[model samples]
Target: MKTLDLLRLKRRQLTTLGAAVSLAAALLPGTLHAADAASAPEPADPHQWLEEVLGEKPLAWVKERNEASFKVLKARPEFEPLRQDLLGVLNARDRIPGVSRMGGFLYNLWQDEQHKRGLWRRTTLAEYRKAEPAWETVLDLDALGAAEGESWVFHGAQCLGPSYRRCMVNLSRGGSDAQVSREFDTVSKQFIKGGFELPEAKSQLTWLDENTLFVGTDFGPGSLTDSGYPRVIKQWKRGTPLSAAMTVFEGEAKDVAASVVVDRTPGHHRVFFQRALDFYSSSSFFLQGGKLVKLEIPDDVESGFWGPWMLLKPRNDWQVGGSTYKSGTLLITDLKAYQRGERKFKVLFQPTATRSLASYNLTRSHVLLSVIDQVASKLEEWDFSKPQAPRHREVKAPFPGALHLASLYDSELPRDELADRYVLYYTDFLTPDTLFLSRAGSDERQVLKSRQAQFDATGMRAEQRFATSKDGTRVPYFVIWPKGATADGSNPTLLYGYGGFEVSLQPGYSGGRGRAWLGRGGVYVLANIRGGGEFGPAWHQAAIKANKQRSYEDFIAVAEDLIAAKITSPRHLGIMGGSNGGLLMGATFTQRPELFNAVVCQVPLLDMRRFHKLLAGASWMAEYGNPDDAKDWDVIRQYSPYHNVSKDKTYPKVFFTTSTRDDRVHPGHARKMVARMTELGHEVYYYENTEGGHGGAADNEQRATLQALEYSYLWQQLGR
Candidate 1:
């Protein structure tokens, strides 16, 4: 469900499957022009008023629709029970508390029924190993919000490592991208008066030292880029006005953002500047002798520092030092040598046709590579201590689930102690998450925590199946069959996908989904189609812009494959996706309405033509394409869901969900689509959450309500 529209480009999520269905003749060039002609007010978007977001009329419309839809959805027999069960899962005190190492303690944020917001707490690693860790609260979000009279959602805190006494805590209202960063003293558990703080904005700040910060925020009108992100990165000194901050780096208004990332890695204190040219590419620079020294590398190639070692992962084929390195190859070189125009490198991981490096992390002495074989995950550890000839070893991990790796190394700790230890989290549809602590050089590991299963999984089983697309590309999908379910095409199956942005959909557990859907005998499917990283860069690049329709076609192929195999018929099949996948849901149903009976389109981008005009929409032009350009529009207009909804066709009773606080994708996309479809005599259900940003839920209660509403709607539409 990650929008991955570069909320500062920590892009780790992807999209689901979809279909390339039929396009009505009304969408033809002449007809499109006519419908968009001068006679119509705003032409094709007569329901443009809905895009006004918080306008009086739009809010009233949202309220009325929410009330109307909830009245019926609540009346369903399965709704309340589902809601209660999900709420239990959401508020369960026994749930594993994820922690991060900060100085002498592991910090965690815990929320329950009483603590609707959360508690920023800490405990010793020894205490964390216990069944019930004794937590000492550093800050109580519910208390802070109550005392401040702000509906603050904690966006996390960036504490200065080594000492970890000072922290920049980010808080967002409801759950928008705009974050207010306040400096806090961890020792006193209080915000520093008159310390460095930024008002609500999509801002980034890192502690260069206790007295200075590398800041990127909206300073004024010209400070923000066209995408509403910070165009300038400044170094702000303590006890100075934000306007007086010295500009360290600046990017053009057309660029996504300019940011300064300060790495206080003990002795290797370096300041890196990144100017994101687009959503997926950036030109990186480092401060050398008070001048910005640009990294002479491909803009799309990811470059980072691991101690004195330079890490590079080229997204495109890079030829250097008289040899060509293929895309998705993870290479390492000495930083000092690389800076001196020497391209001498050692290959840590090379991609085969079917295997691509998913992710990698560095310890004091090891390089842990998470690779993808077909769609499964594998871990490889390279002991980079001996730079010339590193030791590579295969790390055995649990499968049919995801194996997540994270370095336990705290930069503040002595390089020798914590750097070699890492955490691994494994989970799937049925398996509850198990957190393991392992040492890089040793195979032995200790289980730190394991989540209790919230659903009955006695007879449920998951299997991976491949579907041949129209272009003969084999798309993989995982299906979790419910107990006693037959393959006679009668199962109420819910197929989920998000096939965009190179974000691979790996195996993960969701108690809400498991209890409310699969536990109720619903078959769940996950599609690994084009526009995902399942097969790496080539797979993702194959579905961007003009060729984006391939993602839909690949998704359609999976649905067809399911029907052919008699797993589920069209009547009993439903589809669900969010963000870009929401657009997939829209395009799929419009193209082939008979293929699915239910759709849960959440926080989606529906109008492709005017999407650039929306909040953060301008940033995605590189991924989607510049609709302002007529050539790109020629192809985009075909798959644009809002434009393709046919008045003459019979579509499913689609359910649309969005949030008023979703500052990323505009709520107008959902509003206008619902308005257009409903006006065209189509049965549609719409719900606009007044809070909750792009995720469509603010707190656990709201999240539970959404699940209840969605599953209830699915059962009504697709279940017997």
Candidate 2:
């Protein structure tokens, strides 16, 4: 039989048996709370309960569940079909609509077509009335060839244009190192002189004026291997030579860039540079009309990590914008008055627990705060006229899921015409996205433009389920299942998660994962595990330090529940995670290899022993313990997959993948793990892309091809 036909035959057999296995497991269970600690107090801290149930290691439950789920999923004869469909869905190109207001016109960038190797092109639309309207290209990564063809990639362009006639594109390149460069040009499309470049370092550029610019550069202080990007902000002028870069503000110690806002008053121009080392430095000088005064926001020494440190914990929120004349006010969030140690902040509007102060823009008097709260996603306007006392009111609108704000343009139109009128754009997990020209506080809203209406979320269900970790903590995950799947279980499921850093994986529609995976017969689950900013800061802190094993346990519980609930048996179950999630997959695989039939590990950091010495790993030491320290190493070594691979044990079919250009998590981690696993007589598939950064592939075609190969491999293993 053909490979696909064989897979289909195996899938059908597994589906029929999977239902029986799930029912048997559920009926054979001793008690629902058997996983809980017997002697633990009724109101014991969830962490303590987990320790009691899972012992000091706390990964036992994951192993147990993996075995149980694997059995049930494997029983299903239709398992391979569903698994293939899931993989196929993730391989297709699904378009999303993106809009930005540029040159006084609403421009849309939508998925144009599947280019070479299944990559999607983001084509721009200028929305002109004439038949032969001009088209401007925003980003063209298509020039970056497939992963098999290249060894480097350029991405993340922060473009700024002081006037319509001139623009500056600040882009970062990733290969051996993350480097930043500035491309200067006139609005008339003429190249300018004295561009800036840095090698083997990460940098960001902010334009102070048409002629002056601020560049932040990070240099490795100690041995380059052990050093981090200690930052210094420099000033560069148009006519100055490359060697003439002048230092404007230097931090007392290891200060990194937190935030930078530029304000121009009547007589002088001021720049606010907030450093991560707990200091805010401002540069103010006399301009043509008004006196420029630079102010530094002092850091609070008390509370340490929770103190008023710009880098550690930002205590204030300031919005900077201009009016019709490019004049705006700065609104700061005052946390000094609140009792110090409280984890929460009171703002003008209800703050989304998952969102930070990152999604706000400030004018002189009003603050536009984007809130992604549960039911409604909105922007709240706060009037900070009184420095000590600020007032806030909600700005009503039709747009929801406005988690990201592009740029707030200054309108010269009258208040009667523009006060209620504002340009709003946003996208959600199910919504393709839309741009609107409507009044912020007005009831009337009009859709100015949309891109890729072909995107749809019909008959899809997004369910939020809570899984109790071995430690008893309630972990929330969003599961997206097909419309007709039986909740009684017996469906092929792919569980996904990324639980590191305080970054919350907000529910946004993903064409790559959705169209390629879930659109078929597969179920997709996004585990919002700990070490993320889902609930609050405390939620993340609970999963940090020596208690980090709770994150792995939390992921395991979800997989176990899926099996006990009969979603699919273990034979058809698969798990995939990248980056920190890559770490997650490794931990899960080692702790409970039998729980999954196939595992896809991408650009993973399996070698925890040397993680800190690689790329940006040193900077994240605060999050993960210092493995060099004896006590820390003891705990880290317990779950470090690379160190724990045993010659006596058999692991599931595994694919260790990475990109040669992945400077973030060095490809060495994947290479070392693959080498070690292969040496141990384990079957492991290794495919390293030559291009793309910490993210696997550079272009759409490369991404599509990689996904296809990945899905094909996954289905061949688990689907059968």
Top-scoring candidate (lDDT): 1
Model 2 gets an lDDT of 0.52
Error of 2 at 133 (Å): 7.5
- Superposition TM-score, candidate 2 onto the true structure: 0.70
60-119: candidate 1 lDDT, tens digit per residue: 999999999999999999999999999999998778888888878888888888888889
Give the TM-score of each candidate: 0.96, 0.70
Report lDDT per candidate.
0.83, 0.52
TM-score of 1: 0.96
